[model samples]
Target: MNFAVETPWVLAGLLFMLWPLFDDGVRHSPYPWLDILPSDAFSTGLTVLLRILGMATIAALVLGLAGLHRTEQSIEHIGHGANIVLLLDRSNSMDNTFAGKTPDSEEESKAAAARRLLTEFVAGRPHDMLGIAEYSTSPLFVLPLTENKEAIQAAINATVVPALAYTNISKGLAMAMSFFDDRELTGSRIVLLVSDGAAAIDPDSELQLRQWFKQQQIRLYWIFLRTANSPGIYELPTDSRNDNADAMPERYLHKFFTSLNIPYQAYEAESPDAMHKAIADIDRLEHLPRHYRERIPRQDLSALCYQWAVGLMLVLLALKLCEVRR
Candidate 1:
């Protein structure tokens, strides 16, 4: 534990401690009768002890005036949580209700529901390191992996419906994967993709996606916000009849993600309740024991020194009050 002071000159007051050695400060009384008592040595020792205490009291006061303090170093905090990257879709389609139309009732739009639920998710994971990225025509890394809950929620809330005419899921996933690069992170690594529409990726991007997930050992999840009358992941696209029709973009994308040799799950959310359940399931599955670091800043110690000085002075006062009348 290191100590520092605001005013070093105040320490000169400690020189008074040497005064006791020169004089001993014991007065000689002229009464010859009392001088013969064997109390001389005892009186000398008591005077020395009192002078030392007096110097200590003064030192404490001087240190308090000098503003003493100690610095706090960084510390490690352990917890059970994951490093989660929220891959959000900001395509214009998300601005509609699940019924596939602009929201007319008090019902929330798909984007609004996602933002609200994700805000709740971020708040609950205090120890987790989280990042967020949004995509429409391309990807935008909104916030880097961190434990700052406020910034994460603010990024989520700030997302506006994309003006682009496409959903670039490939670029979005690639950006999410980039968050884990060079990071010495442990615990469950995840990429939680939330989208209401789908678009196919190029063959090269798909190969890169597989390699990234496998190399980083990241789990993948897609929360498909299903609009009414749209083809679900398991169903044939509207344009085709056969099961092998890679016709529907979502179905093919789902197939591709599942084919990767890594933990993956896709949820089809047709309503707000289903959306909540999907997020809750992800929350339940991602927790695992891990260690994280926390930095605590330096704190002032002047008040503590003042407290000690007051306590010592109180002791001295009590001793003086009980002293003999002479």
Candidate 2:
């Protein structure tokens, strides 16, 4: 808890507090035959207490004017969660429902469903450092990995816009992988891909992606949002001739991910409920104890200072009212 002041110049007013100590703020009167009167220790103690309260009130007012506050800080602790990056597909197909039609009043689009479920997933995992990236023709980096829940939720909610041209997942995966660059390896790293379709990656890009996954030890999870009559990640072609990358891109993509020799899982979701279940499974699987840093935002202390000043002023006012005059 680092304390700071926004307006240092206002602290100069603390010098006024010395006035109470020097004079005690009391009117002096002459009394004859002072030697005959015994000293009253109770009156002396009350006067001293009143002087201290006066100085405290002045100090509190000055501190309030100075805008005292605590600086933002980061704290590290052990937690049971992973550092996950969500790689969402923004291709045109995601704008349609699971039945391959524009969403109507009774149904929601795949993108909308992903956004809703992802938001809930983020809320549930309070300790995870989550990031978000979207891919269509190219990868769009929405946010970096951090424990800021509001920013993560906002990034996920922003993905419901109209779809882009195509899905270049290789580029998206690369972008997502780059998020862990220069980051502390304190826990499990995961790249979660949510898409309705897949695009074939070139031979050179596949080699680079494989090396990245191996070197970083990152886990990959794919949530394939299957539309009507669409091929699933495990579905094989009838003829061996159609078994190539171009024919069954989703299946081949899944195969490529598995070939990376890293932890990988794929889920085929035909409806919103299936997507929810997939997210739930992910939430359950990534619960490993690891160290993570959490940020605490800056806080203002001026209100507390003013409250102290007001309370002291009331006490002084009561003392003044109770005083008797000759």
Candidate 3:
């Protein structure tokens, strides 16, 4: 009582194997299986038509499946969610040394320390998506919004402290926005911007960036690594930015974030523990509070399947022509 349509190629292959031995062109003698076939004029014509139909079907099936795979890949990169783009400045100030947990040898600069912290940080952040944009003279996506924590962590840790690399905050922010624009997001978006300072940028660039941030409704937060003028931070055996300097670095950062309407915080690392804590603070701020929303409905694919079915029917016509002359 149960019946179902078979796959086009499979059905064609089954018919093809049987058709060659039973068709009218197959010279009906005591021809093995041909005796099982009917000689009724109506049935004989029907069988011949189906034999030709089956061959055309097999060809259509092969091409249709290939087309499906191509379309799937072409549309694969579309529709991602709102993401956290981590923007970091890779200028020389990033190279100042700091002490790690055990202070003996010289520690790494803020950039290196942050990278190290990111390895463990990514392990805990599996639900949220994140991207990274490194800035010096220009900005580039070292990693895009991805759930692959290991790859993201490795890329982050590999970052280098400046050895006065160019500092281009304006360029970095704009590039991050462009990357995020490609995704499909319903949740509130944010950008976690970690930088030493942007004392080198053109004045108009920051203003333009600030306007863009406000217009887009993206949250921006700061993590300032103190090398000089920052309190409780000293030039220990470890290297650091603004180490034992004055309050200028943190103060300037506060004003910058304030002007952009971004929530701001600072961390001073004369050593490693302090640097680790800074990264921890960033992980804390990443919790996005939002309203629960409905999911987008799955796209219907039956139309595509129907199109394949129609294309196959057309190919079946070709077989009728191939044998009609005979």
Candidate 4:
């Protein structure tokens, strides 16, 4: 408890209350000889008691006027979970449903399905520290790692817009990696990347990304949304020519992630149901100890002081009413 007032000097006026102990206020009474009687001893003690109560009431009122309160403290909470980052791709191809992005279609678009399922995923995990990032031509950090489910769901909802830009996977990965900086090495930290297409990464950039992931000891999961005509990561080219390798981008991207020697998994989702299954699998795979802190705001003590003052004043009022006319 502490005072928050600008002028605490008013507290000095409380000393004046002690003056009642040394002298009674009565000046010239007609029956001055009655003060020397032995029977008046009880009345003398009562006067002292009433004076002390009055002083206490005045002191409480002064303290209340000074504005007393305590400092805010943080409440630390621990649980079992992981730090997961949702890396979503906003390429134009993702705007379509798993069947196709055709006009006047009744099926939900891939982006819409993702938004709905991710919102559900966030709602289920009360302990996990989750973050969101969306990438098109560049990466955008939608939210930082936090236990705030509402904010995370809002970021996922905002990603449902049309995807007119091209996918930049390398930059997206780089942006996701930057989030773990200065974060404590606790629990199971992982990145859940969701995308429908893949792009090539330069050899220099690939080496740096691999080394960085190894240093951080982070896990990666790619929830690949397979379209109707796109080649899957496991499918091999029918052509014998060596140049056919370039046509299978997903395979090379999967190879690069595996070469990092870190924990990694890839799931191919062909429909909305498959997408939900993939997220559930990721949920089961990533589980560990999670530590977080929440702030508890300060509370004021002025109200309690005022209550004490009011109670003491009521007692003094009762004492005065019972006093005799002498």
lDDT of 4 at 204: 84
- The candidate that wins on TM-score is 2
Candidate 1 residue lDDT tens string, 212-280: 999999999999999998889888544446444245788888889889989999999999889999999
- Cα lDDT, model 2, residue 224: 97
Pairs clashing within candidate 2? 136-166
Q: What's the lDDT for all of these models?
A: 0.84, 0.93, 0.58, 0.82
In model 1, what lDDT does residue 239 have?
47
Off by over 4 Å in 1: 1-73, 160-164, 238-246, 295-326
In terms of lDDT, which candidate is stronger, 1 or 4?
1
Cα deviation in Å at residue 291, candidate 4? 2.5
lDDT of 2 by residue, 1-326 (tens): 79999999999999999989887766677787787889999989989999999999999999999999999998988888999999999999999999999999999999999999999999998889999989999999899998999999888878867889998989999999999998888889999999999989999999999989988889999999999899888998999999988999999999998888899999999999999999999999999888998889899999999999999999998998878766
Candidate 4 wrong stretches, greater than 4 Å: 1-72, 103-105, 242-246, 295-326
For model 3, the stretches where C-alpha displacement exceeds 4 angstroms are: 1-82, 99-106, 157-164, 182-185, 228-250, 289-326
Task: Please say which candidate is ahead in TM-score: 2 or 4.
Answer: 2
Q: Runs in model 2 with CA error above 4 Å? A: 6-13, 33-42, 239-241, 303-307, 310-326
lDDT of 1: 0.84
Q: Roughly what TM-score does model 3 have, to 2 decimal places?
A: 0.56
Q: Which candidate is the best by lDDT?
A: 2
TM-scores for every candidate against the unseen true structure: 0.69, 0.89, 0.56, 0.72
